[model samples]
Target: MSTDDADHPLTRAELRARRAAEEAAAGVEAAAPEDSEPAEPSEAAAPRASTAADAPEAPQVPAVPTADEPVTRSAAPEQVFDDTPGPRRTPNAGSGTSASTADAAPAQAEAEFPDVAPAPAAAAATRVHQEDPPLVPDDAHVEEPPADPQLAPPTDPRLEPPEWQPHPTPAPVARRRRFPLVLGAVIGALVLVVAAFGVITLLQGPRVSSVKIDAQSAIDASGTRMIITASQPLAKVDPKQVSVSPKAPFTVDTSGRNLGIRFTVPLDDDTTYTVTVKDATGTDKQRQSTLQATFQTPKSTIFLLQRNADGDDTIFLTDLGGKNAVPVVQHEKIDDFRATADHLVVATEKGGTSVLLVMDRKGKNQRELKLPGPGFLSNLQVSERGNLVGYTFTDKGISATSGRASILVSQSLTGDGEPQIVTVGDKMPSIAQWAFVPDSSSALFIDFSGALYVEDRSDAKAKPTALGAAQTVEGISRGTYTAIVSRGNDLVELNLADGSEKPLAASTPDFGVPGTIAPFPGGTLRQVATRDATGLPTGQIVTRVDDDGKATKLFSVTGSDAIMQACPSPSGQYSAIVVAPKLVNNPYDQSLLPLPTTMQTHIVDTKTGKELVVLAGFDPSWCAQAPHR
Candidate 1:
């Protein structure tokens, strides 16, 4: 785990010195000098005599003393003649040298060299040199020398050259510390190898926790039993320390090897959730992620207002419930009309030509819901499934082609033609502005004036027939198909069996009315959440009717600004809006003057009309990211 410590500063000189020292100490060994020749004993005799003369008398070396110490010589013999190195002619040995030097030199030369005695010296000087007898028999000679306490007789002449030789370097002193050095080097190498392997292993490992889901690939409602899988052990995470948000009320199942959780919600709706894992110390590797069948709940009032900018009718998709104003589409020439969803779709002019563009709910392009030849579709209707599309347009030579539209009924595998007329109807509906019921026998249509119509296309081979105006529209929910409808502020409901209308409630000035209706799968189209006469949200309350047909407020908007366009969060608990000022100097000016300074996106807890988050300059589109596996 340790490298060079980087916490402290090291100067360049210090670093270099440290590196050099490390290198020098890495590989240490004993070194020897080149020469290995042995010297003749006489070579030491001269130095011995000279050293005795020059060196002061040394105190007698201490010895293991007996009761009576043995007599020790004050002056010792210097050397034997064999220990002598260079030519030593003794002519001046007696004359030039002192008498004591003469005496000690001869004795030392004889004792140390062991070859300067008269007989041997005389024979060696007079006779020709010859080899000595072999010490061992040729046939019985041993491979190795016999062990003896004493050293070998001088060195054998057989091993020595018959010439003067330089002094042999003494055998290098055996370094006893060598073993530790070798051991240390080996350990260092091993440590580096292991460290490198560990680093490589760690670098290649994944940093994010893997999450897997068991059982159903999709969740249909809350309280669905499910499992969230993890790659590591679950014990590392403490449930008490962990936090799962969106707080949609759910029970976590931490008993298994992998972390699994169960969900419970008041309303049965699809939701996506996040589960955060923390240790007992409230710390975690990072935040763990998972998703389930959950959606955003729009429990507040939001709006969008079409603004005029750059001589164009700019349509903004927003949550005007607060200080948010997001211009969905802006153009100087094109008429900016809006379509609703997590993603936006619009019909605008590009290069003086009318083109159908299906932008993201935020007015960003996905695929252009394009069509050929258009004066620009005046009315465009998209089905809840986003499959059925209907629009009205005027082509060349067509004078106010009032209600020319096409529906997807014919193209779908399951659809009966719901229309035969190619023109607008005075009262009965015209063109292809209706969606045939699932049975393909009857159809439902929303007129330009926001009136609901039931059409009978059972006799599709013949002319289609109108089922007449719906008897009661009071609280007639698009989500529940059970809401009361109002006729000039007179609210009523219809008895399905008899088709008879009954008034539910009389008009009340305090209760705001509905404008247009949009359909939801199994929920109610609660209310008309918008601005009132004061340019502030007064009718900014959600009105929902229960099974008892009693309508009441589900949530309220407490914002001051009038709501323009309201887009519900996917879960329907939050709303995003675009706000507009009450007055406009020029509705169609090429340059918008003095626009709202803060054009940010606002998010609020729809249940309380309490603001949650505000993101500046960023308009969020409902782009869903689901678990891949």
Candidate 2:
């Protein structure tokens, strides 16, 4: 090689031509034997002008080492060849070949001399020459070489790796990105936990979630319902499993998740009652728990009537303390009055006839009720459950066969319809005394013929049930379906439901046979006459007789003060004793059901016989009807 060629390196075209010629000669020598003549060069082996499309095809070659495998070669003076394609070399001005034709030379040489081994030194020298400066000037514009079809296509721009940077994300930005994920995880966990707890609670026994009780209703009347709502639906509850503190009679009914406890009788006023149901369970019966509720009843108040012959008679509503007495109703002459849960029924005499006035508890809205005819009303009584008021009526002008005399009649408190005449065998018989059965529309009446009959006023088709002969129906026990009646010489308890008769037992500690018996829940209130050794009436004693024949002395009137009537409070907690102070001096009023003008009502506790209060009134609202003389 010349010095200029050695310094500047021969152009790639000249190098490739020289390498191809040497490989073609070596191939021809290897194909000929020692005794054979040298083979002539073929057109394919000789160097010629070629384009990329007209380049000679590559010969079949033996396996070569891959890019990753280590290659070894001998240190021989001969030229080295590589099977790997290299970068295309630009042709010099003296060479008549293009860059494409120069690129095809190496492939052609490798095909002709398939046994040629690669040299490390030559490969290093070729790489060094490739990195050197181009033979062309910097000012000249050179064309980019065309892509070789044998090589893989360039990688897609979209698939290229993104630009790298050393910037770390800001702390706040990283936290903001992760906040939603963390919150979602926590909220999901909380929801799952709450759902699990709710399922567990439902699988267990019923627990009382809430309770509702009408305190006013509980203290004022019987059959008041207290509802206990549970967390889940409950199983049936039996009455035997229920117990009430302070010992009030009650019936149990369970529906769905609500447990209803209906007090069969009124509860004591201003008292706290605890009701417990034992072995309460859920509908599945998987577990058992006790369901209990506590409620406080409100204080009770009562109404009393004061008849004044000189002025307007007044009906006063007062608490047991007798300090706060409010006049509720006033009329010229009030013969009898009865009070219900929300209303008052007052019987007043106008001219010579009776007028019935129904008013609210405050006596603001007064309305006249329709009567059977122009008659005198007596024995006014009210049934709170049936919303009815009953009375005995007698026509003002009454002859032997012309007018209605002491006939029993009942009507609605709203005065919507005419009074219904009570009948036996299609005839309106004269009733001597009648009383409403507690909590029902049925009436227990003693006709003038001395026959006791129970008739259901709610059903017009139902006939009266005759209960044989009875002197008088003293009183009926609430919820017991039993009535205390005076039969001949003995007092008997008549079962109004089944017509069964049993002698009324005398009070223990023997108060002697009572003159008047007033039946209430839990017991009866009796006004017994105290007699001297001479067998003469000396004084009056009001006694409480319990269900088990236990007797307690509640009140007494001695000397001149006389106890006209003894009545029990709704729950038997208190007794109202109507007394006339200075009996000889107290004159009788001119009303139909007249009492002494100077009458006083004494409120006494039945259990302890302690007198609560005394007020100037008679015929307390606690009594079902006016006292019969």
Candidate 3:
């Protein structure tokens, strides 16, 4: 080779032409027999590319070494191959093997130094396609090396590696499983609906399974309550549809499946009341039924005290039925007495002091209660519950001229403690009248000046609550929510809860108002009234009045007969009317208080207006329900 050609190198086009000729020659040689010796090259093998010296320099190709011939390796430009094969071709100017392909230079450098990682397929592909120059032959002379007998011949184009081809996808799956899943869901939903309907069918009807009541007949001024339980859940109750005989004021409660009947007013004694609930529907509302019950209240009996002018006084027990009349006990100069279920409390005057006694129902086991001081007891009363006995007493002090003051006191009949003085603000008032609050340790009192107070006896030092002013305190009702009071000639019911007052009907102008009020069935009151036109009360009668001031006479007397006072039995079935000879003309107060020389007490059935019995007595009262009775 000439020196200029060696230093300037041949143009790329010349080099490429030489490489193509060499490759064609190799193909021809490879087609020859494997053992045949290679033929000598043509004269073209001689150096001839130096004529076009201004052409771009072509990349040098390193001589390939063979096992038999040790050919010297020239330092050639680095060439990098990619993992994914591209179109095969002889080395040319535009191939990524050249340094002129700037983007591929990094990959070629990495290939030259094996320690460096190869460029990724994506980077090599981008350079070859985007930044590569047009294809041109590389015409560098590459000295042939001696062939190695052990090496296999280059792979033929037709015998290239086979590419992977995807297997034919099976025909689209039939989706047979989806049908069964959808069908199962529908069947399950239908089963749930059927179960719900079956459950509803089983509970289609309403039926009353049992009935329970506090009493066959209401035994107290407080009415009775009845509870009815149904077999299944019931719908809302239409209260107006529930039937009650005698048309009394009542309320019905429907909670869950239980039905309740609350009589706001006491039911008539000795009367059969039928409560019928018809057209009652169950929760399912497929069927209706009628439920009914018949109950009768019990008749009432009272204890009468008869005081003799010259001898001992007697306490008698009698019933409105007139069959039961018996004398229980007797005391000398009996001033007042109260009957309880288990015992009888009596007060008698002895000299200047009053004696208090407790006895059993038959007048046996008489026990005297100790007094705080030598005093005379009056206004004696016993609590329905708690077995407490209370009274007002006037202590004469040490001498006749000593200041005489009245004090109120109470003690538990079952306890041994001395009677406690019912006081207001550390002192007892000179009470004109007082009554125990039913079923509680409380009492309502009115001073002589008509100042009403409610004192809780449980705590001795607790201040009493003032309940405004009143002429007289009749009684406490409905636990402590209501108070029956009389102001002048008008009777009023006071709601102690909110301090509201409601007028109660007065029977007649001549009667003023009965000291004793009998709350009967249908929210009606039966009370004693004067038969005469004079307000002084020449004669006596029993009248029934309603809330609107409508009055009806139930029983009456003629001539000079005077009804001193009337008391209703606990169940309101009967009334004990105390009658005395009229004192020509006199006010009702004088006749009711300070028992007359002799008085006749007649027990009469309020419903039938029939006198059951007549007994000689002064003070009459009914006993509360007791274990001994």
Candidate 4:
């Protein structure tokens, strides 16, 4: 509502009448523009012709003009007078009385004359003299000011909602989200495929069928050990039927599989050789099976040396080329012996045997010289320049059951001197392993009681002092500087320089790489073929013991066929391993075990730690050590 309307109230019907009247009066003025001329007025408003009379500006008129007067209607609407109207009539004042131009003429003439002309800003754009059919004062025309412009207010543009802004085109919304959705779907499918494949693989057992060698015979040097491994349970197969062959002649062995093979034999650097299985079957009538493999024999051994498990045997030499060997010693059990520049001292079991034999370089039987005890021989040592000889043996004139074990040292066997009978102790020393102390006149020995003792030769009466409880006592070899011992699960690396022990594993800890170590790495453990606790087929593993006393698995017994027996070969190049990978005797149709699968003797290479040849077991361990390759 406007302030002006709020101040004045009027009935709705009366206000509408007033609005109509205003519109009608405006219409009369708007219609005059088409028919207007500048009028030179003869003034009815002129003062009486003489100035003496008081000017009559506008005289009130009689509605019924004086009886003698006539009505004048000139170019004015007749509706202005009540007595004379065409369509509309003004209200009568009394009888026939009306208001007209005559009454308003004097005022109109003065206003129109305009003694002082109107300024341009205030003047009307179109002048109209058309008389308004003047309205008479009556109940119909009388009205009060309107009351309702107050209650309803005009709409305020400031509060309206903002106009919608139209872009030239819709936004590129779909492509923005498309790439990630596609990428996510592709990734999801890949993951599902991988998951399904894993499930399928698990459902099927170990998938091994056609075994082929991926390695070529040429190039690879650090010689590799050829091993035939089983993917499934081998209780159904026979090892005797299996025969190994090499395309190129080289040493092969199962010892590398049972005993962790050495890793230093480089195929490229060492001489090249290859071995494969031929007629891989066993000869035992009870069983028949065959398993075959071929690998490089990278390094060639100049001499393959080994001592029999029996205490009396000296070194047996075998040629890695699968040739025959000859026995070097026949009479006494020589536990230890060394070749000297002029002579060789041998620890022999009987006094008739020479304590030292002066042999030619060819190892021909030469002159004998006497010195120490005629007891079981153990280890032998020579000086760096070949001037001194150190050897150990069980004390003589004492019962083998007696606890007294003795060691002797001599500058020269012929030069008579008291044999340094360095008695160990009242306790009988059981030999497990032994080594000559480097740069000193003493020997380190590990007894079966797990005690490490050093026999000092400085004082003739000095007993062997205990280093500590050792896991294993290993026998020493020529040019082997230190003793590799094992405690329990760990290997005690005995430093020859100082009587110290460093623990190490017999195999690589990762179990991915094979190594000759003490407490070995456990996997498909290969042990020396033997019997298990249940009296079932088993094998022995030469695991080095740690000072902490732990056993790690190195290898386990695995034969393609039931193995009859396995013995270390003459040269240690190969062990007399008899087995079968394929078993021909079917229990469903058994006929004398289907004529035993072919069994063969295989020469094992100790360097690369593999077999050199696989043949029948007609060979003996008495062969020579160094056979020309």
Candidate 5:
């Protein structure tokens, strides 16, 4: 070689080309017959001495001894070299040569000394080797250097070292490396979605989840509870915010996630009631929603007494439709009967005395309820709230100085104790007219001297409360403790709870003065006598006078038929009007409390003034006691 060529040091491409040529020659020698001796490397394949002097010191390879000497292997681990392409190392500033030139020097020296080839038996003894395992397992895939060295792609000198890094050691092949990474990403996404849903739920208003109510209790008595459950905790609700259709008196109570509504009076039967709560909000108060629910009440069942002068007097139970009449109790002479939630109390006359029989609603399981003494039972009534049956009693031969006379008495329906006699001060005065107050254990009565008193049967030792003189107690309202009583010619509303008095409000359009008034939940049923120009009786009008004094005519009898009595239902939705049709011909029965034999009761809707049905009975179960003459 020329001196100038030796001084210039070969480029990386030239060195790589020369190395490829020597490797091809060594492989050819290895493929030759085993018995043939290996050919000596050509002079052109030898590396220049100057190239070795400029290169970095490589790992020391044990020298192979000649055949004339004994061949021996070193105990040290085999030295390995990697040919896989990788990031170029930064060249040291002290070194005059570039990184590519230094890296090529070792390859050039190994190529020049082809005589140092490894023994054929040792497969791992190679100077240049691939770091990666073969991608395909087949003999046809074994790699070899190209036959023409110039065909290889040339490396650029300006190529930068890569920014990414690789593992220090080779890793085993994995068929499912991405499985764990994909699963982790899916789980993280689900957690984010769940968190978002929870935030939305908390920000919204509460929704009604469920509702519960008892239809029987709602129609039978007062204090029926309806529970409404919400999806989340609720805020407090004021009683004024709640409204019930077919309006009834109620109170509101609230707890966590539940709202309770208690009806203070019996609800109308066979009616659809809608309860609505306005501007109901959740505990967070983030949003507001109106809560509403609807439920229907069961139909009402009433019992009426039909008296027969010849045969047996019967007390039959019937529905408002006047159909399905079932005989509940029968006796030779039936005086009066009253119905409670679950049972019936009938006052029957046996021989010359009075007998009180208590039985189930279906008239089964009949049992006797003892009276205060062996006197007659006149006004029989029941107080459902106290479960007590009361009556006005008089001796068989009642006189001014004989047995007990017109004494008021009460007893438990369960027959657990003796009958209790009501008294005012220290005397059991003769009771003239009396009635049990609605939904209470108190009795509003007037003595023979027209003295009015309120006595609580539940409290035996307490003195009776006197509210001056009242001619008669027409009726007492259910939830409100107001009694419609007559004082002289004007009607007055007496507040039994506080003994306050106020004149009864006159109905609108001024329907004149009514003969009798029966107070109910929201109104009063007044029997107004419609007079003609001569100021004589013309017709009887049963008018419904509301608490606001608005009157609506329910039923009117203009002919010989007379409206004997007009009583309001427990809920005041309908009024039961007893009419003696053909009063001149309908003879009076020979009973203690005589009534026209051909009497028919007209069930009229108080609100719309619609007559529901005409039943062949005088006294309706809606009345607290039989109508007084």
Candidate 6:
């Protein structure tokens, strides 16, 4: 409307280029404009000049045309057209105007209209008409999708993502080798198994460790035994493999791992014995070894009690060879006395009551033994192994044979305890003969009726069991199982365990009656068999017998002199026999008691029939395992 509102006019070349671009979008080839002549600019085509005083008001613009309608120039503003072809505008040749120049002429008139500004509605319509579709290059090619085994149908282009891609599969990882690890584990297990097996095998092998003997010196004289212990269970050993240096016959205990070697005969005193066992094997014979033991036997000795007519009775310690007699003790009136390894026990009588005295082996430190009552004591016997002293005592005023008189009682010399009375049925029985069962607290006693019994003196209230009737119990084995008894003219061994009887030895015409029998450590037995002449036995014979009934005559004396008692030495190598002339003789039952005036004791060898010594003593008590050796 004002002079300042005027804008620049469009050129014919610019309008032609815009028409080509529109033609390309409709899939039509745009033709180049023919260059003929230029047309004169119409008055309406020129930009109008206006003065501020003569300026006119602007005119209202027409509404834009939609795609459904065709557009036509109103002769006053720009027109819009639809897709449908209407009238074609050919270039006028006479006017020499091109189609592009004709189109620009109208656009220039729209700028010159002073009262009308270019409408926004017409501009938008022209842009839509000139818009072109996207171009595709002739050389550009689209790649086809690869084939998939399990293919999915194509999705709608509007729903599918623009930048979608296929996922890649990961490569497989390499596997690790396991051969070395498995082999190592197996080898480790085998090593453990082999180690365990070797340990077990070593434990199963047999070995001999050590040997044991009774004593370093003065080994048991009777039959010294050697104990051999093995590390494992043992089998029966070959006799040829066992030997002793002194060349003595021996028996072996093959029932256990511990081997027991027992020499059958007495070993020489003060001698060394070497034993060897080769090829000692286990019970399964899987292992073998050798064993050896050395033992020495000391010289044996004995103690004897000698009575003087006008003085006191003296106790003498002498060797088994009957040499080196030394006075150990002296008492005014000794009825019976016994010696032990360390002390001497004596039964001395004063007035009517009997007293027991204990003193060291040298006769020092004399102490009086407490009596149960003021009574007369007899049959005083000392147990060499148990250190116990046993005696028969009569209560004051009670007669010796009265049934209620003497009772068998025992007391320990080293142990402290009241005197234990050997009682039966709550009362002491009339024990005529009683002795300590060797190496035990029990006693083997014979009543006045000659009925034998065994009572355990450890319990004062223990009852006595009857062991049947016997003529006389010579001696019981240290094992307490076998007893040598006198039955008429035969000396039989009674098995105290089962009450069975077996003949051991008998008196022959040369030997009258078997008086006292003594058992050695190795089951050998020796007895004094008296020979009778003129219906009264006066001669005596000392014979040794074995379990097989083999007899050996050790000593034989023929005359008025008789063998009162035969005491075997502790080593069983010697015998102390009381020899005296028979004062009163009743042939069948001769009294062998010494006349008290003239009695002698003879020490004789049990192996040989040689007499060692004769001493002026009646009762001979060994001081070795017994009272003497």
lDDT of 4 by residue, 86-189 (tens): 23232233222122222242233234433433322112111211221222223232222113212111112232112211223323566667879999999999
Question: Once model 5 is optimally superposed onto the true structure by TM-score, how far is the C-alpha of residue 529 displaced, in angstroms?
Answer: 2.5
Sort the predicted structures by lDDT, highest score first.
2, 5, 3, 6, 4, 1
**Residue pairs that clash (backbone atoms under 3 angstroms), model 6:** 218-298, 221-571, 512-530, 512-531, 532-537, 536-587, 622-627, 622-628, 623-627, 623-628
Which ranges of candidate 5 are over 4 A from the true structure?
A: 1-201, 282-287
Model 1, total clashes: 77
Best by TM-score: 2
Q: Give the per-residue lDDT digits (tens) of candidate 1, residues 171-217.
A: 34334457678889999999999999767534433122345442221
**Which of the predicted structures, 2 or 4, would earn the higher TM-score when compared with the native?**
2
Give Cα-based local distance difference scores for all models. Answer: 0.36, 0.73, 0.58, 0.36, 0.70, 0.58
lDDT of 1: 0.36
RMSD of each: 20.5, 15.7, 22.5, 30.2, 14.8, 28.4
lDDT of 3 by residue, 298-348 (tens): 655667777665677788887655467798887666767787667788777
Better TM-score candidate (3, 5): 5
lDDT of 2 by residue, 1-629 (tens): 22132234443323333333333333321111112122222222224222222224333332121111111111122222333355433223332211222223234334544445333333332232222211222222233233554431122223221221113447788899999999999999999999997988876678889999889988777889999999889899999989999898888899999999999898999999999989999888888999889999989899988887778999988999988999888888889988888898889888888999998999988999988888898888988988999988999889987999999998889888778998888799999888889988899899999998898887768788888998877889987889999889989988888888888886789988788889888788888889999999888998888889999888887888888888888888888888889989988888878778888888888889988888988899988877665
TM-score for predicted model 2 compared with the true structure: 0.70
Question: What global local distance difference test value does model 4 have?
Answer: 0.36
TM-score ranking, best first: 2, 5, 6, 3, 1, 4
Q: How many backbone clashes does candidate 4 have?
A: 104
Candidate 6 lDDT trough over 10 residues, lowest sum: 65-74
Worst-scoring 10-residue span by lDDT in model 3:
64-73
| Count of clashing residue pairs in every prediction | 77, 0, 8, 104, 0, 10
Error of 2 at 326 (Å): 1.6
How does candidate 4 fare on TM-score?
Answer: 0.33
The total number of steric clashes, by the backbone 3 Å criterion, in model 2 comes to 0
Residue 587 displacement in candidate 5 (angstroms)? 2.5
Using all chains and alpha carbons, the TM-scores for the candidates as numbered come to: 0.37, 0.70, 0.55, 0.33, 0.67, 0.56
